[model samples]
Target chain A: MVNDSELCEIILQYVKDEYLDEDDDTQIGPDSPLISSGIVDSFSMVSLKTFLERKYKISIPDAKATPEAFDSVNKIVALMKEFF
Target chain B: MAYADKIREAYRKELADIRTAGLFKEERFIHSPQAAEITVEFPSGAPQQAVINLCANNYLGLSSHPEVIRAAHEGLDSRGYGMSSVRFICGTQEIHKELERKLANFLRLDDAILYAACFDANGGVFEPFILTDQDVIIADRLVHASLVDGIRLSKALQESYKHNDMKHLERKLEEFQDKRIRLIVTDGVFSMDGDVAPLDVICALAEKYDAMVLLDDSHATGFMGRTGRGTHEMRGVLGKIDLITTTLGKGLGGASGGCVSGRAELVELCRQRARPYLFSNAIPPVVVAAANKVLELVSSTTERRDKLERNTLYWRKALTEAGLDIKAGESPIVPVMLYNAKLSQDVARDLYKEGIYVVGFFFPVVPKGAARIRTQLSASHETAHLDKAAAAFKKVGEKYGILGLKKDQIIAKFGA
Candidate 1:
């Protein structure tokens, strides 16, 4: 089972792999602001949601696609914890 | 001392910015040809088969038409593949002139000039003719990116009105009253939103403001309005538009080409001055011939357009009746609003799993909180295909709790 910290790490890795940016200092933690900081657009949010759902086998309801659930790596971890 | 390293660092930073902002775009590989049914092969070694493609711009279903294919093959035999030179130099073939003439006749325009892509057609327009400091170009905020790029490259004073907001447009026109020439540029049908422009009203305003109207009918040509003559025909203001640009990529047979149609003088001016047309290699004879065949077919019968209209109405009505929030429009582009980006993505994935191919669009393709599954209707789709697609939507909506449980369950229990 993927723990919250592990999940955050995995997501961060996915981001790093997809972007392949060497100078980016974007850190993934519970308090990281992904959407609010304009770090991620709606399309990336969707992709992240799908990645989580497929990776963790959790069905993210439409109602939970709010800023509180996806605003940061930390929020996503919290949401995953709740689902698990 | 290390320019390459510095450039790489900048690209890395840019990539990080894009990743953080969720602006990263990925392309799906469609292994098979673009048709009503296509096969997409993912990197995971999974191949998915989808029916009645809802994302292609093959509006009149002429991309793989037998007649079009035949014409292309004939052109390949007659004119060879490519000219290897720009039109004025040595690329101007008899068939290119024939295709241009046919397009002009089809659009009911005095003349027309071809471009490599609609992007090029737009990119080459405003720069040459409208760059004077005395000129002003008032454009819709939601015009295609190509138009925006062209306007950016020009020296004309630019003013943008809110998307489809006639009042804002009128205000902009009034504000540009002092310019020597004021050009009102807009898309005949906004592609992403699938809403038709009020060309009649716009023409009236242009007349009142003494401004010329330019319509990019990329989404409307060979599809919208009666006989698929586009927005001008739909609004009964055919000749009123000063300049019109449309893609041969979409409804005009999915050939990789574009054309600017209007008064003979404007077209001649573009032919002479438009950098893309003057410098770029002419469109291959195969594509030109195929487009000519498509024009001939669209002009001959309204069958394809009528069928597409029927499919659009059926899909829109059925989806709406099932309680799905569909964007209001009479065009073939129907946007099923799922508001939530995650839900929209899931719904599209689920639909694809059920053999109905569609794409989920979110910002910056649309505004925030307006994510949707933009489903396009083609003349190639039959009643069964549309119903199947709708059924897939109902299932996905139910699974994701987007639609009412009872209604969705009822439909799912009794398979359509």
Candidate 2:
């Protein structure tokens, strides 16, 4: 089983690579705001869910896929842990 | 006056914020009817300029067809204009009944009920069927706003799967097995990407889960299948869809009307309980007659749809050969990917200067960093029009140095 830090690292890396501009130098941490800081939009949030589901073999229901649950890597990790 | 004065400054600040965020929508007034070519006045007081239209939903080119216009005139002369009352009051005319029957026959469903607009049809469809808290409404994430609203009006438990992700949908279906009822909702064709849904798979999933399926075919009804029936026909699942909501304001005749076509029992329930049908005025007789003529024409011949298919193939090929990045699909909606929001707007403005009328789609409409110019093909466009549009697109593509560039390359240059 993937620990919380490893899962957070995976999600942070995916967001940075898929959403951020190539030259963007803003630093992202485990607790950095994704949606609040405009790093991820609604569509991007869905894609992140898909990525996690494919990576970890889990299905995140629509109710649990709320914006607040996906605002930070730690929150997302917590949400995924419920399904696992 | 006191209330207006109190809130005027706040409204101004809100408008200013929208402008600052580049989210304000500006309208271009069309001086002529919607067709392959039309005169448009941009920036309010500007002189009208004629441009080739590539942004309208006129797939079958019946919006300004001479026969349809003539039919509208005949209907106007015969039936008179407005139905002042809603259906079941004084609004139920013979022509209205005829149009609904013709639409039902054309879609191969048991029956159909009309609405003032597809928005109304979608807005009022769900509450009657997905009744009670034990029912669950599972929909695709990318369904249109109308469907989203309709689903929201229901008191049932709401759920959604990833867009076009069948496995995810199946998971949802399996999870909801213990629910009293499961209704799966999806768009027949996604408007932005132009991709058709996998209805065959969806139907099988519904069978396995004992669920009902609803399709919003607003984008694909006029020219999607072998006989232009719908995506149900294209996916070879006619009569299998439990509900289908479509619009006549688009490829049908480009007028203003919509319908919910499906099983007779559900349609009866809608006629009785769907608030839009019972509350809104009837669809005007002119539009009804014009739509009847449209259905008659489509039912009689595949000529227009055949031409549309050819035009779509030719347009997609031309754009691909021009080295522009575009989404791959068989539908008439072709999105030329520019990746940057401002760049899409700039390219659209440049294309307008080149006499091509297309609009840029940016963030919030689509996802961030996925901005594109959505170009739609129509049967009205001749080869010369297609050739001109392709050349102009290449010119704009060259001006922006976006030709032959991949998504990452374009984003690297423009900062998506």
Best TM-score among the predictions, by candidate number: 2
Winning model by lDDT: 2
Candidate 1, superposed: residue stretches over 4 Å from native: A1-84, B1-6, B48-51, B404-416
DockQ of each: 0.02, 0.10
Find the 10 residues in a row with the least total lDDT in model 2 chain B: B154-163
Docking quality (DockQ) of candidate 2: 0.10
Task: For residues B1-416, write the lDDT of model 2, one tens digit per residue.
Answer: 67686599899999999999999999999999999999999979998999999999999999999999999999999999898899898998898999999989999999999999999999999987779858888888789988888876887777777678888888878877878999999999899989999999999999989999999999898899999999999999999999999999888988889999999999999998999989999998999989999999999999999999999999999999999999998899999999899999999999999999999998788877889999999989999999999999999999989899999999999989
Off by over 4 Å in 2: A1-84, B2-4
**What TM-score is obtained for chain B in each of the predicted models?**
0.94, 0.99
lDDT of 2: 0.90
Each model's TM-score for chain A is 0.78, 0.95
> What's the fnat for candidate 2, on a 0 to 1 scale?
0.00
**How much of the true A–B contact set does each candidate keep?**
0.00, 0.00
Candidate 1 residue lDDT tens string, B171-282: 7677668789999999998888899899999999999999998999999888787878898999999889988999999888887999898988889889889999998999
